[model samples]
Target: MSLLVAWQLKDRRVLIVGGGEIASQRMDSILVTDASIAVIAPEHRLNSRARQLIACHHARITHHDRLFLGPSELHNIDMVLTALDDPERSREIVLMCRDARIPVNAADIPDLCDFYFGAQIRDGPLQIMISTNGNGPRLASRIKERLQRALSGGEGEAITKVGRLRTLLKQKAPGIGGDQGRRRMKWMTRLCNEWELEDFAQLDNAMMKSLLEDGWEKDRIPSLQDVGGTCSTRRYHQNFHSTIPLAVGFFVGVFTTALITFFRHRK
Candidate 1:
């Protein structure tokens, strides 16, 4: 049940109805987007992080110095998030949002929320969110940590470079979905497979345009060096395969040690 989606919040208004750590975290996420944010809570209730946001992003965010005033406060609000310690008050705000047809998420109150903010890993053009569908948020966080370790840091820049290449394709071979789209997809896939992560990470503007002009448009894919890329994919595959023997040996040693220790204890 992967129901999570990347909502387009650019220029949309998001209302947060608390001033605690949970609310601060959700507001941190919104700050990355072009969303207009307004937080409602008494000034004294604000945590240190919440106060820091107020001090830093003063121009970008508006924080009301009082408690939520009901649906009137939610006027023109596209989304609502409530992280109040008082569940009753939070629930009341949720009800108001529902009445006004606004999407809402109530922190730690699964049944009242229209959405949940899952553990997330964010890079330039890459965002990975792990959710347990209102169950096991700790596990979701552990999974996010594991994924962060698995990915190479070059990915963010690589994805950004790929986007630049896509933009160039649209300019050189412009068309709105059809054969042109399919052709673009095929070429993009080819590059993703053949080019190493470092190649994309280091793809300069001049090299990017030249690659498209000489390689794709010319109907002749040139040598890797011509556009400053290496065929390191095969080398990486070889390196991965070479580690299998060492992994097997390490696991076998662990199993044998466990068995010997168990038998000694039995004796």
Candidate 2:
């Protein structure tokens, strides 16, 4: 079965049914979702930082301060995360959660888990998730580290710029559909690629508008010509926003320098 992927988890209820180090580690990942957390640990060995976050967020961490093997432990929870180190206990908890129609993830037991936590790398708005289909956690972690080093930089600012351009297109041409959508995507794809070749400030808005109009005209309906163009335009936009602040600063500095130089020469 293909693994299910969920990227957004704001304000969702998440329950961690352990109070030890493993549970603590899982909390670090779950907290990023900004979800409501209700931790049920008998005696939590939370470190300073984890405790600080738990206290600060005012998370509903109900402490049983004992073993959580009872059926009552699974009551009224949306998603359950069982981090108990014992295999049998973890399996039991998973079964209990399953009976209650609740999603559960037993520590180191991906087969039992309704949802498995992938090794994750977060860089600003960009998140890379790596999983090993429940075979090897260590392998997954190693791969995650490699991906972390590889994709440690760049983000979606360029993508966001393309989004803004598409919005502009929709505003200008209300009836942009079928060929229009294809054409808009094509122009966006090309512009985003070209954005890498020069400064964003050098990207003439008039030229972009002209190109977008032209592409839309051609692809207004899927013709044989459209297929060939789309085939040749297989290149997706590169990670152009790898140095966002640098790009922004460069543009800003160039503008200020030009303005000053123009006024001085005019004088």
Candidate 3:
């Protein structure tokens, strides 16, 4: 299985080796991050949208209006994306990237890709990425659509509130080691588990700030039980039950050890 991770691309340099629709789409995706982008393709070959995007980010993006040279151009680049129509040119770029130790995503050719750009659902600090191990992009897109719909109602606001709460806790709690850090982590995790989008949607910034300042009093915190059965509680219980066999085995091992110790003392 391929290990998935989120790469930090802020202020990093990325190279795009095509200027067509696929290249434009890839450019759009990378633009969301604070990466310096360079597009190397013939000036007249780029689509209008691609041209516009490049012009819009002229300060951060540099357009080379020519075909890619040898591996010399790969120096100092963190990643490369080749959306070239020519399979031979794409392969050449991939080989050069591999030699330079740079990760690459060659559009439409899974075998040449070091990574796949999966469909993503982003909502104000909350992001969910869906991938199908390079087997089904369309299926991933469909799943992303369903997830987007399910997460649409007031979730953005909820995530914003949670983010604010976390910042407040960090400022108040300060260090994240030893007893203080563990306490803070426990408090935050419990709050996240119990709270839902509906609960945060009704809360104003002032109230939330007050809750933070007051150390999350029992009366101040909203109870999921009052609003009917909580899905979070059900999920927690389900997880607990699933681990019962392991828990039983652990207890049995401890009991057997204690019994052997008692018999040795008697002898």
lDDT of 2: 0.64
Candidate models: Cα lDDT each: 0.85, 0.64, 0.80
Q: How many residue pairs clash per model?
A: 0, 4, 0
**Model 2, 149: alpha-carbon shift in Å?**
3.9
The C-alpha stretches of model 3 lying farther than 4 A from their native spots are: 201-204, 216-267
| lDDT string, candidate 2, 8-80, tens digits | 5575677787766778787778777767777766544555655665677675444455567577876666788
Error of 3 at 144 (Å): 2.2
Candidate RMSDs in order: 6.6, 12.6, 13.5
Q: Which prediction has the highest TM-score against the true structure?
A: 1
- Whose TM-score is higher: candidate 1's or candidate 2's? 1
Model 1 is weakest, by summed lDDT over 10 consecutive residues, at 229-238
lDDT of 1: 0.85
Q: Write the per-residue lDDT of candidate 1 for residues 91-171, one digit (tens) a residue.
A: 899899889999999988888988778888888988888998767889999988899877767778889998998898888
Query: Candidate 1: lDDT of 82?
Result: 90
